[model samples]
Target: MLEVNHISLTFNEGTPDEKKALQHIQLKLNKGDFVTVIGSNGAGKSTLMNIISGALFPDVGKVTINEKNVTLLQEFKRSNYIGRVFQDPMAGTSPTMTIEENLAMAYSRNKKRTLKLGVNKNRRAFFKSALATLHLGLEQRLNAKVGLLSGGERQALSLLMATFTEPDILLLDEHTAALDPSRAALITNLTKEVVEKTGLTTLMVTHNMQQALDLGNRLIMMDKGQIILDISGAEKQALTIEKLLHEFQRIRGEQMGDDRAILG
Candidate 1:
């Protein structure tokens, strides 16, 4: 459903701070494929998501959704084709807006709009039903300020908000990294539910190796911006953290003892 072909990115070009963030990375996601991406820090995990979401441009590459080239598209233009939940909870939500009001914006994303800010009764019912999926009682708290929510609650709502329009691709950038373990687990499960129910193609960047193996239909490991490993189907089902770590060392020719991966 989505493809990244021959993409590379370099930051601070021509300066001492110059760093190559990605190196000819190529990847493809089939329809309904939940691909979990895992790697050590600086492995270009977030960079790949940024490129896909159009928050960052590639030095060279082509990004396509269903065969259409979106390489040169602006970030806002890409938003029409994609849904994203960032690492930061605040990034995806408006602090001042009430819960239902925030969703009203998302509901009207692709549709033409005027100054009609009031939520119709049917749309209100739809938002309530969607909020119920989060199991946070947000459906009953539609008038509450989003800023008053806890980290986990906010993240759950953010996930709901991102998938509100059901775009072509869903980019989850360590979405649960900010929540507590129990809350993270809840959101992770909710992630699977929403994606499966909506049939949304998803790319999830996670630091937890176990979560990577346990959640997605496919698995990918990266190091230094290059995709060094990819596995799916029965192969992915049989994967263990030990085996994944072993593969990283085998392909990247580096030690596989990153605490982020081992302990996460």
Candidate 2:
């Protein structure tokens, strides 16, 4: 359960390069709701995610999670309630750390540190079981440096690590965009499985129109720092890529048939 109320953010205000990245944006995601966000570059998609995850504070308005106000909470302080997987596989993981070590750190998040780096047998067993669920054979390579993993593997592990404790909200920022098509699909399916299995409330930003439509219970389209379209239930069920493209063109009053490069 997350509520973003009357949120707005701007960069370089009162300057020549001033820009309003989000304009009075408001969004509500119920518990277990998986919302897919799609927008062209500079449409405030990632900005919204950042605001929710506490990476950026809104110049106006508040963010509430599970009825607790976190608008002023620092990013690191929100880790107990928020989980995030970034666009870059390398961003969420330490390249030099071993797989189990990475997972151990995630597992130890929000807990009292004991100055002990060695993994206890029980924790190691849990990490192995968790990695096994990825089905990427990472369980066998718990001691291997994460840098040796492929991009997709690292991203998958990132997903697992982020959701290990089932935070109140999951923020996925174009997480699969860097992987190849096959790996992207793999991560996509894995995302759905993990979220559904854990009943994790999720907000995922994606550029691919088909992927946006094919996943999530609700879909939102944003442009020029505002939500232009919000579709769900029967409306989202009846929507198609062609209609979505048409609506985007109509709302922006521009030619988009050739803008697939920017949108997707």
Candidate 3:
């Protein structure tokens, strides 16, 4: 459902201190494809997602959603096609808004807003059902401010809001990176569950090796702004973290540098 073609972005080009984030990167995701992206720091993982989400426009190349070219689309213009959850729990939702209010905004995203009440009987019923699926007792706390939630709770709510409309593409920028092991696992499980239920095409950048292997149907490794490896189906199912590390070191001709990825 998403296609990125020969996209490249460079910062401070033609000057000292220039950095290239994406090096003509190309990725195509099919409908309902769940792709997990892994890489060391500065591997263009986040940059790729930003280009897809229109958070950062590529100096060259194009982005398409459902065959509609969005390369020239501004960030706000592309919001209708993308749903993003950042690493920071506080980035996605309004701290002052209640759980239901935040959901109301999500419900209205990419559409004209109305002067009617924020939550009517039908919307409350839908909200309650959606919140109940989080299994966090948030359905009963619709009036609770989102700021009152824990890190995991807030991130979980953020995930819900991102998928409330089931955008054509879901971009997850290490959405669970800030949580502890237990909470991270919880959020990760919720993420998979929500994606499977909604059948949304997803791109997730994660450092946790096991979670990467366990969650997505396709696995890819990136280095120097290019995809180094892409595996799927039987091949991906049989791959282990140790083997992945070995492959990385062999391909890059250096030790894999992500200690967090190794430790996890």
Candidate 4:
């Protein structure tokens, strides 16, 4: 339901520090498609996400969602169709708001705000029921401030908030990167569950190789602002971490430099 066509971007254009973050990048994602993006530092992974989310506009070409061109749309305007969970738990949530309050706000994200902002009994029950699916016992903490939660708990709640409305597309920008191994795994599994349940088209940028492989139906590897490898179906099914690393070495004709991706 998303199409990125012939898009290109450069930073500090015509200056000494000028760098091309993306170049003639093209991608099309169908409804319910889940794509995992992988790359080393400065590989344009986050740049691509930003462009799609309207946080950055491409210097060339267009971004379309559901056949509507949104290349010139503002970030807030595009929030109606996009749900995102950032790398930092603190970024996606309001620290002072209670869990249910935060959820209430997210639920109203794309809707017209009414004069009444308070959560009523039915909305509170809905929030509790939704939080219960995380299986983190957060349903009992509806009134607890989100700041009181642990990193994993906050991230889990953030995930819940993002998917609560089932936005047309979900962007996960290394969402579990800041958590410990155990919490990362938990969030990863939860991500899969939520995506499957909602059938939300998704693009996830991850430094973790295993995570890239283990989730999503399509895998994209980018380098130097271009997509170097795109694997899916049978090719993706046969993929392994060792083979992926070898392929990277083959493509670059040099040792892969991102140690976090290699070690992950």
Per-candidate count of clashing residue pairs (backbone under 3 Å): 0, 0, 0, 0
Better of 1 and 4 by TM-score: 4
Best by TM-score: 4
Better of 2 and 3 by TM-score: 3
Model 1, 1-264: lDDT tens digits are: 899999999999899998899999999899999999998899899999989988888999999988999998989877888888988988888989998888998777667677876587888999999999888889999999999998888899889988979988899999998888999999999998999899999999999888998897999888888998989999999999888877877776778757978998
Model 1 regions more than 4 Å off: none
Ranking of predictions according to TM-score: 4, 3, 1, 2
Q: Which consecutive 10 residues in model 4 have the weakest lDDT in total? A: 109-118
Residue-wise C-alpha lDDT for candidate 4, range 66-94, written one tens digit per residue: 99999999999999999999999899899
TM-scores, all models, native as reference? 0.97, 0.96, 0.98, 0.98
Residue-wise C-alpha lDDT for candidate 2, range 24-108, written one tens digit per residue: 9989999999999998888899999999999899999999999999999999889889889999999999999999999988887
Q: Where does candidate 2 stray beyond 4 Å? A: 116-118, 257-263
Against the true structure, what is every candidate's RMSD?
1.2, 1.5, 0.9, 0.8
Cα lDDT computed for each candidate against the true fold: 0.89, 0.90, 0.92, 0.95
**Which stretches of model 4 miss by more than 4 angstroms?**
none
What is residue 76's positional error in candidate 1, in angstroms?
0.9
